[model samples]
Every structure is written in C-alpha cells, then in structure tokens.
Target: MTSLNLLLWIVLGIALQVGLFLGISFWQHWQSYSRLRQGLPEAAEALPAVDVPQKEAAGWSGFRRLKVARRVVEDSSGHICSFYLEAEDRQPLPSFKPGQFLTFRFDAPKADGSGSEQITRCYSLSDAPTPEHYRISIKRVPPAPGGIHPPGRSSNFFHDHIEVGTTLQVRAPSGHFYLEPGSSPIVLIAGGIGITPMLSMLNWCQAHQPGREVWFYYGVRNSRETAFAAHLGAIAAAHPNVHLRLCFSDPLAEDQAGKDFHHHGRVDVNLFRIELPLKPFHYYICGPTPMMETLVTALEDWGVPDSHIHFEAFGPASIKRRNAGAAIAGDAVAAPAGDITVTFAKSGKAAQWSPQSGSLLEFAESQGIAIDSGCRAGGCGTCQTTIRSGEVSYLQSPDCDPEPGSCLMCVCTPRTAVTLEA
Candidate 1:
C-alpha cells in the first residue's frame, strides 16, 4: 500500500527474472559441454549416422570370423554341408526368427589381377534355436565338382576355406516371414530347400507353442536329396500336433524312404485336398515359384481367403515385380504416369521417364545413371529410394524405409508425379 513497498516488490521481480535467465543459459551451456565431452560433436549429432545397423540387418557383429567345422556332410543331387559355426570371443549370439536368413560376407580370389574381399550372400538358417552355436545346412548348386559358383559364392567360400577358427562377419538375423500368433491350424508346404524356413518355424512352435496342429508337406526330387529327414521325424515324434509328409517325385529302387512316404508324387491340388482337412486354417508355402503357384491355386480352390495364405520365395529373387493384387486399397491416389522425373540426391543426377519407359530407376540406368542394386526382383531392399514430395507405386511392399523418405527404386513406378531422394 505504500510507495516504498511497491518499489521493493518491483526490484525483487527484476532480480528473479535476471536470475532465471542466467540459470537457463547456464543449463544449456552445461548440456553443450557435456555433449562435447561425450564425443558427440555438434556436426556429428546433426548428421544422420546411427550407432547401430538398421534393425532389419541386425546380427552382423556376432558372426565374427570364427572357424566353423563340418559337423555333417552328405551328397545327393547336391552336396549338403552342415557346418557348426563357432562364435568368436565366446560372446552370446543374437536370436533369430525361424524363417530369417544369415548373410555371410567373405573374400575370395578372382580371375582378375588381384583378390577382392567384397562378397556377400544370404542363406537360410537350417538349425533350430539352441543355446550353443548356430548350424546351417548348405547344398552346392549346379552339381559342379570344383566350380566357383557351385557351392555358391558364400557357401563355397565357407566350405572351401572357413574352418574351426575362421572368423566371419555374421550379421544379425532379419526377415519378415514370421509365424503369426493365431489359433488357426497350419499347413506348411515346402519344396526342396524351401523347407528350411518352415523347419525353423516348426521347431520354434514345437519348443514354445506345442499344441498347434501343423502338417508339414515336403517335396524333394528323391530320397537322397532330402535334407533333415531324420530331424523331421524326430520333431514329429516329439510333438503330437506335428505331422510329417514326404513326397519324392523321382524315386529309385534303392530309395526306401520313398516306399513308405506319405505321398508318392508331386504336391498338386488333389493331393492337398485329400491330405489336408482344408478347414479355416493358415497355409504357409515356400519353395520355388512353381511349387508356390500350385499351392496358391489349391488353397484358392479350397475356398481359402488370401489373408490366410502366407508365402515367401525360397530360391533366388523373382525377376518380376511383387504380386500387387488388383489394386492397393489404402490410398486411392493415382500417380501421374507419363514423363515422370526422378532425382538421386546423393549422386546429384536426374532422369526422366515417359509412359513408354518402365520405371524411374530403369529410365535412370538406361540414361546411364549408376544405382547400385542387387536382387532386382524387389526382394532385396538394396535399391531403396526416398520420396521427397510425390506419390509412386512400388513393385513390392518394402522391407525397410529405403531412405528416411524414399522407396525402393528397383520396384517403384510413378503413380503420381513423384520426386525421389535416393
């Protein structure tokens, strides 16, 4: 109420404001100093470098070059080499999903003047989950005795050179072909090597969720080429819900396993209908495309919904685009087609495409744009591109965000006038 009291209050308010400002400024300065001390320079934080690999490519570190040995070896149509991979430094290996794969990177001599170490390839994990080291079963391709690509780029590298102490750059297990947690019974249909993923799933289920009925229908050329027959029998014996069915398309007189095999010929619609109950159950199919196509048609004829059928290509990636059904349902927006422009932000190159041209990446490459790509079949996400401000149609559903904003250039088609930061 007095003049002196009002003057004192105003002075106190001014002091409080000044102290607050100084305290806030000191806090920010302390933070900056702490960050600097932690070796996170301002520019480093501003940049988008991550401390870890992308989740989809997680397990590379644990696969340090450790020597692996041939635990089991057999020759049928192809040489199946089962190697016991040891972990270096005795560190615990990362866990992997049943249907996921392991990418092995190695070095080998080339026909050129020098040896190149830049080589990588993927192989499905054949062994079940265990506390010890991982085991992978490989079949040498093309029936080559000493060919480079026979044991395969990665497989041969492992087979020919890698031994008990050979260290390898093993990546974390990453894959999308996972078993959905549902109550439906399962029909696992696989062909030859395609059975690897299904075998993983069956093992996982047997260990964790034991009661789900699973009928495994495996097709091989003959009894000799059938890998893991004994293991499949053991799994079936251990689990009541698990049923094992083997089909040998070409059986020899010596093929005793074929004599008592559940199915004698290839897995066609008639065989599936007769063997499977065809109730509202989930169907997991893998193997070559021809096998998958047969299974899909069989399931369709049995009135199974598309949602209930899940599959992944086990062999090499398909050259064609991913099956996109009739239309994409989420966004009805149409991408402007003709004369679409694509820009590669990193390369600082732009390419133009007309409706007559196939896609932006194809156009860019046709015009001599170099975009590193593998598995052009949309399975490998190596050719990912980021979308800046436009719409596009992709040949397949992407496994990862190519860039923070891009799509896979290998499979993307201009849906709307689109721009890409690849």
Candidate 2:
C-alpha cells in the first residue's frame, strides 16, 4: 500500500477507538440515570440529593427541647458565636425555610435578683437545614460603656451561660421571610448579625439551585467583626455561579485587599448598579435598620418593584412598603386619617389612635394598658389580640398569623373605631 493508504488506516483506527469510548460512557450514564429514576439505592451516591419541600413545623406554638451539640466562636473579635443544636428526642427532623427563625425560650435571671423568669426571643437559623442539626449565629450585644443601657439579655445569656450539652427550649422554625428554590438569579445583601438568615438562604441556593446565579454582598466594619469569612470565600471559590463581594468599612492595616474582602464601604443599591447590569433579580436584604431602610428606598427609587425587594425586620416594624406614589404607611388598606377611637376591652380603657401613633400595642402601652408581647416585629404572635369590632391595617406583613378574628397588635394600626381584647 502507498504511504497515503497507511495514514488513512491509522486515522480510521483512532476514530473507531473514540467512538467506542463515547458509546461506553453514554451507556454508563444512561444506566445510572435509569437507576436513579427507579429509586434504586445503589444509584443514590451517583447524584445530588433531590430538593424536597420541607414539612411544616406544625404545632409551632409548642416548644421542643434541643441540646447544644457544639458551640464555636465565629469571628476573631470573640463577640460572635455559633451553636449547633440537635434534637433531644433524637427523632427525625424536617427541613426549614431558608430565612426562618427559631424562637428560643429561656429561664433567664431577673435583673432585680427576683429569680428567673421565662423569656422568649427569636434568632434566625444560620445554616442550611438538615435532618441532623440546626445552627444559629449570634453576636453578643455589649452594654453601654457607662451602663446607660443594659446588655441584651438573650444574646448575652446565650454567649456567657449556654454551652455544649445544655438543653434548651426552642420553638419550631417559622417565618414569612423565606426563599423557594428557583432557577432565577438572586441578590442577597446582609450586614452584621443579619448575615445569619442570609447565610441560610445562600447555602440553600447553592445546594438546591446550583446553576442559578447568586450575588452575595456582605458588609462589616472590619475583619475582626466579620464572621464566616473563610467559609464564604471557600464557597465563592468552588462555585462559579456564586459571586461574593465582601465590604469592610474599616479594615485593619494588615488586612490585604483582594484577599480579605472585595470592596470598601457599606452595601447599598449603588453597589448593585456599579457591578452588574440591571436585571429582574429578586433582592433579599437583612441588615441594620438604617441599611435596610436606605437600600429599600434606593432600590425603589431605582424603579425596582415592591414585590422584588424582600427584607425582614425585628423589634418595631420601621420599614414601610412604598408602592406607587402613595406614602401609605399601613399597608394596602388606607388607614383612616386623623384620630380614631381605640379601646382596650379587657382593661376597659378608651384611647385615641392618632395617625402619628405607632402600632396598637405601642398605643396601648402609651395608655398604661398592659399586654403580653414578644418579638415586636410580629413574628412571635405574642401580642395577637382579638378585634371586637372595626378594622385594622398592618404596617408590614407579620410572620405569624393570628386567629381569624384577631390581629397582631404589634404591627397593625387601627383603621377605624377599634376595640381590642388585649
């Protein structure tokens, strides 16, 4: 045969080998996929875990006893800590929504040395949910330097008193601020301890919707105050779809640029505009009140819809939803202008609900009428009161729902002559 014939034969042999290799690979993949579709146990290891909707934490009003499995300090400042909690009963666990919070009931010591009193506080879940455990990151709120204000009771107690092996009462996770697994790109902005819920949401997004684009903007004062820096960096390094931008307003001189963080200054809507082309991206924000307010307003002014910007607030509901040009502070229903009659049916006290007043709970307190309240942002349902008559408008959506005839007084304002059984 000629030289050209020999070369042609060699090329044919290479083509045959390539075809055979591809055929075998395709067959193996098809077999593995078939096994997975058939729900075969042997193929489970070959694929990612399927994302299933989490079961509801029914009877959430009741508390579950959880034992602290581990407690680790997160940041170099030693003010932030994470606790790993496991079921004391060792029963199977259900996953929770990414942004949900756990209500903790503690028998904390009374400030006046009057023994311990049961107090309830809510803290967001800080990690992805699993059948085995839940994690929460907390920052210790220090007292004022000259003792003008007392230290945070629950936060300090958890840091200084609670430790591994301690059994504590925790209500099942529940909150309206949550993300459903979706293929759409999302932006998450967090500041300080507000990073807890955002962390949970980010982990869920990565695990369940790995292909979705995610932009995480985290801001803190300095490296010392930043938690989960290594973990977040590792995640960004591993996942191409995840873009992490860390901003430190006051980085130490030793902290290197491009190594410790990506940006300098606080997180705001301007950061989004500077870095990315505008898209219909859903924004999840959890941060200090000022940051939350500024971002919400700026994004709205940038023409983002109210439906796209999501955030959660604790304590008083200070963030107002601004849709259209109407500056309605109390939700979709226009609250009656001027003064309205508000009566505490239980206390038999009549008070006027003025437009300048806050929530019904706040107005009640101003009137020296007592009402049991917790998680003043309206998540705990502790201040839900039965509406005897008339209507009320919510300043913001409450995480917890009240009975059909009742309303969460902590977040609602009287829309008309209202009588509340507080």
Candidate 3:
C-alpha cells in the first residue's frame, strides 16, 4: 500500500472507464448506421434522385406537343370530362408544382366545310404531378338559354371532338398560384369546376405530406351536379387529417344531409368562421367570380393577413369587390383621357377604344375581328400580339410575362393610339 501502488491502481481504473465509454459510443453509432442502411432503399424509391440530372430538362422552355391518352367521364350527367394527355414522343414530361395549369391550342374545325380556326384555352391540372401524363377536367359550357350566341367553342369542342390519340399542343405547366408545402394548416375553398386545382393540391398533400392538416370546402348547385364525388369521398376517408365539407346551394329532394352534402346553401364566410379555428392558416381559393370576391373580402374582414390569402379566378378576371363599384374592380385599369384609336393591322379594322371595352381583346371582338384568346386574365398568353407602334398598359401584372415588344391583348388597354399585329 505505498504511493506508487496507489498511482498505478488509479491509472488502471481511468483506462478501464475510458474504454467502457468508447465501447458504448461505438455501439450507439453502429445502431444508427444499421437503421439508416435498412431505410436507404425505401427512401431512395420514395424521393427523386438528387445527384442525377432531371430526366426532363430543367426550367420552363416552351410548348411540348402531346397526345390525348384517354378520356374519362367524371360526372354521372356527362357534363364534366377528364382528359389524360401524354407526351407524343413517349418521353418523360417535366414535373410541375401542384395547382398549375396547362395551356392548350386547338385547331377547331368550323361547322361549315370551310376550314379550321385556331382556338386556345387553359385548364387547371386536376391530378397530382407525375412524369407520365397530365390530367385536366373541363366542364361543357352550353350556349345561353335563348341559343342566341354560339356554344362555348373551346369547351364544347373538347367534349365532342377531342378523342383518344388526338394530338394536342400544350405549353409546359405554369402558374403563379401553387401550393407551397409547409407546416401551415391548409384551407382549400373551391366552387364548381374550380375544384380541379384543389384536387391537385389535395392529392399532392395526401401523397407527399400525409401528416399535414387540410380542410376542403366545396360548393355546387346540387347533388347531380357534383363532380368527382366518389374521388373526394375516397380521399377524405383515407386521410384522417383531411376535413371535407360540401355545400349544395339547391339540393334536390333526394339529396340528403350528412349523406350527400354536409351543408345546405352556398358556401360563405359564416361556415368557415364556425368550423375553422381562427389561428393562422394558409387559404387557397379558386371559384366563380362572385364566390371568389365574396370569400376574399370576408376573409380579410376576419383579420386574415393578405399574405395568407391566395386566390385565382377562372375564365375572365371579373371578380368585383363586394359592394365596391367602378373604383375597385378586380384587375380593372382606369381609362386614359381622350379617345385612343386601336388599329388592327391584319384585319385592317380601326376602332376608337373606350373604357367599357375592358381590354384590347374585348375591343377587337366587339369589332367582329377574330383574334384567338384564352384565359383572358392574362395567364395563358394566348392573346399576345405584336405591338407595331404606340404603347399599351396592363390592368394588373400578368401571371405569364409576355415576350419583349408584344402585349397580352386580353388584359391590356391602349395607353395611346396603338397599332397591333393581330
């Protein structure tokens, strides 16, 4: 029991303790590495490759011609149809963010045996993104009650003429309205055919972020008019985090509450206020003009920040503010002083532009000058025309930026006496 013996014993004990600690750390590291190795295959299969380049080129380039793969009747009444389109060359298509749209150009045959005229339209992508194909659901828009004007040229053409194997030219998917996958609770509000994009967002969230909470509120006229009922029901049943609410403004006698629809009457802020928590939630809405305007105003009044509320109006950009008159029409620019002359170079038609005409496209149409136009809110770029001379101004910045020296006639007005190659 001398000092040297004591020192030797202490050194031996310290070495043993260090060895034990290192052994435990090595075992823990081995366990984590083993678990990660086991999960590697599944993770690789679930997510896209990070190191390899994207199969389909990166960034939006231009239109790609695609062929119609198939068509499916989504509703019992045959009013709504879903078109599945695939790349004509059978190559992988570029991926898109959920809630984007596909712009299509159609050479619709004239009723007479004269010839075909070019028509353009934009439809929201209805399904989640996949490399193989894209899907768009379109509602057939019949002519007005009196049959005065012709039926919706593009929609009816798609419903009646387009078939499987038909080749169609479609621009790559593009849109400002898209879902940003995040931890924020999502509230999707859709009306009638506007549910297409919502369906895309819903399916994407369910597949990619299954744990995210989602609440979907959809409105239609009646049970018979309800499109994708079965599909929506299946989604709600599968995803426990999703809350589905359907409102029928005019439910038929057979339409039963809690079975066919969750509520009766049009969807308004009152329903949302009652059902949804007042906490921060990202709201994405798309619908008819009136419904979009009403909900946007109501949500703002409910103390929701402008940044949290996102919306897209289908067809023309005609959402007027609730109770607000000419001063604050959605996407409407004020008329410039003096009469601006708009000369169509191709048609050789000159018209004095008025504020009532709304847009240059509208002015040309009123003059009986045929100009192919689509998504008149300026998202599609279908009505982009060369401005030969003079200036034009936009009511609001277009979602799709036009090429230099050209203007989207659908949302622009003559800033001065303008000559356009239309």
Candidate 4:
C-alpha cells in the first residue's frame, strides 16, 4: 500500500473510536437524566409547598387562643403542675425548637372589685414538639423568705384555678436558647425549674438523634424538690448514648447515690471539666441566677469559646455573684455618663437612675413602685412596659419581642430622660 493511503486508514480508524466513545458517554448521561426526572415528582411532593396559604397550619403568626386539654399533677418533690394545651379549634400544633417558651396572657379578677388585671408570663415547653398539644410544667413559687414580695401570682393561679376546659391566650413559641442537635457532643445543665426546657431537648435527641452523645447534669435542692425523677430515670435506662448526672445540693437520708442521685454537690463547670472531654462541644445551661453566673464565668475562664456557651437565667434575669467583680454574660450594661431621671407616669414617682442599680426594674423596686416581672433575663415579656417618652437599650436582645411601644424593663436601661406608664 502507498504511504498516504496507510496514513488515511489509521486516521479513519481513530475517528471511528472517538465517535463510539462519545456515543457511550451520551447514553450514560441520558440514562441518569431520565432516572432523576422520573423521581422528581416524589421529591417535589415530599417537600412542603411554599405558596400554599397556611390558614389551616398548626402554628400561628400571633397570639392564639387555646383551650386546656388536660391538667395532670405530676408526682414531684415540689409543687410542680403540668398543663397540656391544645388549639381551641383542635387544629394541628406547630413544631417548636427544643428549649423555646410560650408566652401567656392572663386577665385575673382583682379582689377589691377594681376590674380585671392583665398579666403576662412565659413558661418553657416541657415536652418534645408534637402535632397535638404543648405541655408546660410550672412550679408554684412561694413568697421570698423575707416576705418582701408576694408569691408568684401566675404560677399560683395556674396551680389553683387553671383546669381542663379553661381557655388561655398564648403567643407562639419563641426563644434564642435552643438545641441544634448534630453529631457534636452536647452537655445540658439544668437547675430547678430550668429542667423544663432541657427535658424538651433530651426527648428530641432521643427520638431524632439517638446516637448522639448527650450529658445531662441536673441540680436541685434534694429529692424532695426534684421533678421528673422517674421520667429521667427511665430515659437514662433506655438510651445508652445519654449520660444522666443528678446533683443534689442537699440530699435527704433516703436518697441514694447510685439510684437517687449521681452527685451530692452542685452542678458546676468544675464537675463538667472532670467528666467531659476537653474538646469542641456545645454547652447549654439554664437555671437560677447564681448557678448560671458561676457556670458561665467558669466556662469562660476555662477557655471555652463564648459561642459554644449558651445560657438562660430563670427568675428576674439578674444573675447575682458573690464577688461583685466577676462579669456575667447577658447582663453587661453600658453606664450612662451622668444621672438620668426615670419617671413612672402611672405611679407618679420619679427616680435618679444609676448603672449600679442594675436594671430599670430594680430601680423601680428601690423606689417602691410596683412593677410586675418574671424571668428577668428578658426571655419573658412579663416586665414589658410602655416607653411613652424616652428611648431605652437592652443589655442583651430579648428572646421574645415585646410590643412596639413597650420595652422589657428587666433587661433594659434608660437611654435618656425616660417616662414609663407602669
């Protein structure tokens, strides 16, 4: 054969091979596209429709009027009551993130026939998210030892009067401190009634992320004050990934170490330092002011990243420290340059504001002005009051947003000459 003819034959053979390869590749690509297109309908159906109106949806955009579905007296060492609430229309409930709270509005009748008084209180959801109902566990708070203030009006009202068939007006679930479960290890710390939110997180983890490692450290006065002992015990027994540590500051004689309580002291960061791995982990804390203050400061001193530490203060949002020099998270206030006057229009009282007074609520109390408050940390809107004249700033942004013209006195400081209708 001639040299040119041989070269032409080799080039033709190469072209044919290339064409075969391209055809095979195109066939495989087309097969994949066909399979994906076939499954598109199922995938689209599984996703929630965004354009559909949510009128029949379980969650509400604003305050919803719900009826008390049931009231169960949970067996506890303290006077804790659980109320199961369902939508008055018997609609499905919206799912909430674990550790969120529901704000309630109550119009309790006054004794002196001076008309009804409006009170707002917030309670953490005590159970996992369900489509049927929401549960809240409330502890009856008695008067302080000094008898300076009255007993918890909202809690006492729930325990005394709220029953099945009663209607309650509640806002949607909202809060900043919540669990975002992942493969990362988590440590949950609770004190007293703070266990309500933690229980929600624990139950969610058990149901959704059973393999995730969870360390729950709960602290209480003693067995007599501990709530959900049997429920916690049962959970610990069933889940191997969960490590339950019960810390009783003062255990009774009948309380055993292995069975009744896991530790006999307070649940502090020091206890966590010894028990948990010194690695990147999320730490969620909720409890009394002192406990939260101690744990947050200790964790910061121990070099834990601030983003990793999440906490919520239980009552009045003020975390008091034994040593005044120590700083507490979510309580840092910017001191004003000079003395500012705060006037309570309804009470007809005025006071010189000082940063040392802590919060506007504290200053009002010092001036002998009666102002209602709950969960002083700004998570609850109980301390919300109308800011009629002046601007105020929050030490930390509130988890539950207040009304447009109002501010949370518990965490707010006056920015100018302020006038409030409280």
Per-prediction RMSD in angstroms?
21.2, 9.6, 12.2, 12.7
Highest TM-score against the true fold, candidate: 2
In candidate 4, the residue pairs with backbone N, CA or C atoms under 3 Å apart (3 or more residues apart, or in different chains) clash, namely 316-376, 317-376, 317-377
Cα error of candidate 3 at position 217, Å: 0.8
What stretches of model 3 exceed 4 Å from their correct place?
A: 1-60, 320-354
lDDT, candidate 4, at 177: 69
Residue 261 lDDT (model 2): 84
**Candidate 2 TM-score, C-alpha based:** 0.83
Candidate 4 deviant stretches above 4 angstroms: 1-58, 109-116, 145-149, 319-333, 343-350, 365-375, 380-390, 403-406, 419-422
**For each predicted model, how many residue pairs clash, with residues at least 3 apart or on different chains?**
29, 0, 0, 3
lDDT by residue (tens digit), candidate 4, 137-230 = 9999898899887787789889999999999989888887678534456789999999999999888777767766789999998888888888
| Candidate 1 lDDT | 0.64
Across 279-378, the per-residue lDDT of candidate 3 in tens digits comes to 4577899999888878888977765655667788776765543333322324445458678999999998898997887889989999999777778888
- The model with the greater TM-score, 1 or 4, is 4
Model 3 clash number: 0
What C-alpha lDDT does candidate 4 achieve relative to the native structure? 0.79
- Location of the lowest summed lDDT over 10 successive residues in candidate 1: 45-54
Candidate 2 residue-wise lDDT, 180-271, digit = tens: 44444578999888899999988887777776678999989889989998999999999987999999999899888798988888897778
Candidate 4, after superposition: displacement of residue 413 in Å? 0.6
Worst 10 residues of 3 by lDDT: 39-48
Candidate 3 positional error at 287, Å:
1.4
